[model samples]
Target chain A: MKTSRFALAVCLLFPALAFAHIGQGDIGGGLVAGFKHPILGLDHVIAMVAVGLWGAQLGRPAIWVLPVTFPLVMAFGGILGGLGLPLPGVEIAIALSAVALGLMVAFAARPPLWLAGILVAFFAIFHGHAHGAELPDTANAISYAVGFVVATGLLHALGILIGVAQRWRGGAYALRGGGAVIALGGLFFLASHFSILPGLDA
Target chain B: MNHFNAGFVHPLTAFEHVLAFAAVGLLIGQHGLQKAQFLILIFPLAVALGAAGARALPGLPLVAATNLVSLILFGALTALAKPLPHAALLAFCCAFGLTHGYANGSATTAQTSMLAFAAGLFAATFLVVAYGAAAAQYLLQRKISWIDIAVRVAGSWIAAIGLMALAIGMRGGLGR
Candidate 1:
């Protein structure tokens, strides 16, 4: 009787334990994958950070405006991509975004508010398209989208946090230096996309 | 899960629901505590009514779609960080609460007692909204410009999530 009771308990517990798996192609899995998508890509990471750094460098409304503009516009691009609407040269545009945005940071370029918003919006489309197009078929779409967008936003926050250092003397130089490195990294990615960088092309 | 526990956990389980609830609280809280206190009551009442009415409603999908729209609307309103006409805001709160509550209600099993489940749901939803309102009130009291900006940024994040989710849903990839 004791053995039978124990066996019954084990049977009851097994299914519950089995159902506890995390990231196993459920909403949680989709979220994890989507969150990882932007962070895992070096190109995406730098470009997103550049947006924050540039925003900080510009100060005021631009600081907040650029971050707001990116995600909303990115969602539009994502919609286009989800619908299988082809935007020509997505890869090239993504690579170019990094370079251009990074260079803007490196130079601490502060264009007019509308111009800056337009520039950021332009690059956001490519990034959003890349993410939307790459969404896994098995994943929950909403969760996955939430994951990537949140991840992207956090990356911007990270850049903004780092950019805050600019308030101190000599911090500006460091920020500009960071931007140059990002620009260089973007160049490497651009080159690899063209197969011009040996072994770096993934 | 028991009916009460199931109903309690429903809003917390879904990302969109959580966002929408928090956005409503934040938006209301932005105005002032008195407004939040009075306005917040409308949500649970509407929720209870919607949940009760869910048995008669035929289209679960429509409720869900509206819920997503509510997510976007609330997030955008919060991000705008501007005051709106009181009546309009009230209407938004009631409509959203109804839709979201209906969605929550449809998830219930027939074996459960409706009263117990609704009580649990009300408790959970109220806590989330109250917490959000309190947090926003705290930030407003600080009078820090950056805090306001951060709130706006958070609002944008919510809106972005809604937009992406809507797009993906439209693409026929939501539940898949």
Candidate 2:
């Protein structure tokens, strides 16, 4: 009985040790960790949702294309990160995506579909690189990839839902307001990362 | 015998492979078995050839890509239910089966008799496809629109999974 208990205790500690290096635990497995990464980070959540909102605003083809383009490009970014390639200022750029995408939503800026795709894909590299850089060494790569990609897509879908609210009266205003809020959050994230915001650097 | 068993069990092991055939089966159910007769008959033969080809040429490019695309295309087709030409549908099934068979074939070792492995694979595919089609056909025939909707939603999820796999393959980002 004592041996079994000791085995259980050691098993429990393994997961903790696995996650301790990244400074984020509470979640286990590479796939689950990857899934939660986007949702856990405020910057990733806002930017992903903002992409969906922007896609919804742009309407069909953009709706699907934008979401699809992100992971594809993000994967390329992941490859770069995995290969130990340096991409300067990934954190700053990720924060900037939220700001830029949020502002696009707030102002109801409608860029051409190609342009929107390009913009979203460009930011996705930083996001992907961040994810790739932190991948758990012991985690299942396929599952982790699946988890994060799906999580990102779901966030985009959530934003699309919010953007679709425009079908109702004053829905457009509500969306714009939501965009402003996301943009505000992005600014704070950017500030916090740069230690520009008081008490956030800690 | 172990080789035969391995071949039989191979398709069942992977979620993606099971999902691929299940999607095909679901389509057959939705459209009626009669309409999909050619698909039902030709898919296994094509898979056999693919598995053989894989054994012969281990360096088949785009096997993963093709498999992923099959998932996406089939899932989308299930969701849309857009009427397609018979030939188009047949071609889609054959192409999907071929890729999956190739993957399965390549996975088997040289010690495994290719014939036994192929037989096992064909048998497994047949059972899965037939059972899925029958189940969907029976349950969905109840005239419940929501059931149809649920199937469509499942289709979307499958497509999403495929898209995720595609991204991973593109970047080889999943940690080794």
Candidate 3:
């Protein structure tokens, strides 16, 4: 009983290390790595969340429309990157996406639906290119793609859930405040890209 | 593992197969159970037939491409939330089942018992389709506005994954 208790305690305490073997191979590793890619990047997170915030602010069809539009456009962009096609200033554009979308959320800017979608779609290209270009040669490609897309969708859902705050009093201001922080973060990323912020990589 | 277990676990193990199966279920389920009952039966039967046929047939080309296309087709259909004629729906489900099952069959060894493997495959396929249908039916019956939007979003995600996989495949990055 004591030995079993000790083993159970060790398992609980070191679960990640214990389960480390699960993701060591091609499929599982690819899934885990792909899921982590967008999430680990602060720039990606903020921009994706800002999309949801802006969508929620726009109300009605735009709320669902923007989230739906993003993944499809992003996949097209991924195809380009996978094909080794070059898109200019990808990193800069990615940072700019965060800045632009963040500001849209911060200012509660509600543009025409088509314009908003076009803007989101434009940014999605940059984000997708970065992910696709970095696709590991060793991992299972299909699993990796599924992992990343699902992760990206969940991030958008998170932003949408946060945007749900719009229903209450002062919630709108809170969302704007969140948007401003995201915008500032984007500027920081941009500055890092430009070498203005030394020692910090975006 | 026994052939039966191998066949049963095969579809669950493959991400492409799971996604395609789920998409079919969701699309059919979105139309309601009464309309979906026929399709639900047709899909698994087609899978069994495809798996059995794989042994006698010369290797089919573009199995991977066809599987990815099925994902895109079924997912896009679900996302659109548009109704199809019964015949069209049946044809789509049948095609999806056959191609995916053939892919699964090609993976199995010749020594495996065809009867046991096909039975396992059919059972697993039926369960997946049923589960997907149930989830979609539950959501639709609830009549909540967000539930409808959520299903569409899920559909789009599946389609996006399919498109991305196709892109990767074009680059020769995807392994069989």
Q: Give the worst 10-residue stretch by lDDT in candidate 2 chain A.
A: A18-27
Expressed as tens digits, the lDDT of each residue in B120-164 for candidate 1 is: 778778888888888998997899878988888788888888888
**Residue B62 miss distance in model 1 (angstroms):** 1.9
Against the reference, the lDDT scores of all candidates come to: 0.81, 0.74, 0.84
Task: List runs of model 2 lying over 4 Å from the truth.
Answer: A1-29, B1-9, B15-41, B48-99, B105-120, B123-176
Evaluated at residue B121, the lDDT of candidate 2 is 86
| Per-residue lDDT over A1-202 for candidate 1, one digit per residue giving the tens place of the 0 to 100 score | 9999998667444422333222222466489988999999989999999999999899999989988778889988998887789999888788888889889988999789999999999999999999988887767766887899899999999999999988986999899999998988888888998889788764
Q: What TM-score applies to chain A of candidate 1? A: 0.86
Ranking by DockQ: 1, 3, 2
Query: How much is the lDDT of residue A42 in candidate 2?
Result: 81
Among all candidates shown, the one with the greatest lDDT = 3
Residue-level lDDT tens digits of model 3 in B25-140: 89878999997788887998898888887877848888878889888888888888888898999998888799888877876676889888888889889999989998999888
Residue-level lDDT of model 2, residues B1-176, one tens digit each, is 76676677676655567778888878887787777766765777777778888988897777867787798788778766666788888888888888989987877677779998898888888888888788777878888744665465456556655655555445553212
lDDT, candidate 1, residue A12? 42
Per-residue alpha-carbon lDDT of model 3 for A28-53, expressed as tens digits? 64788789888988889999999988
* The 10-residue segment with the lowest total lDDT in model 3 chain B: B167-176
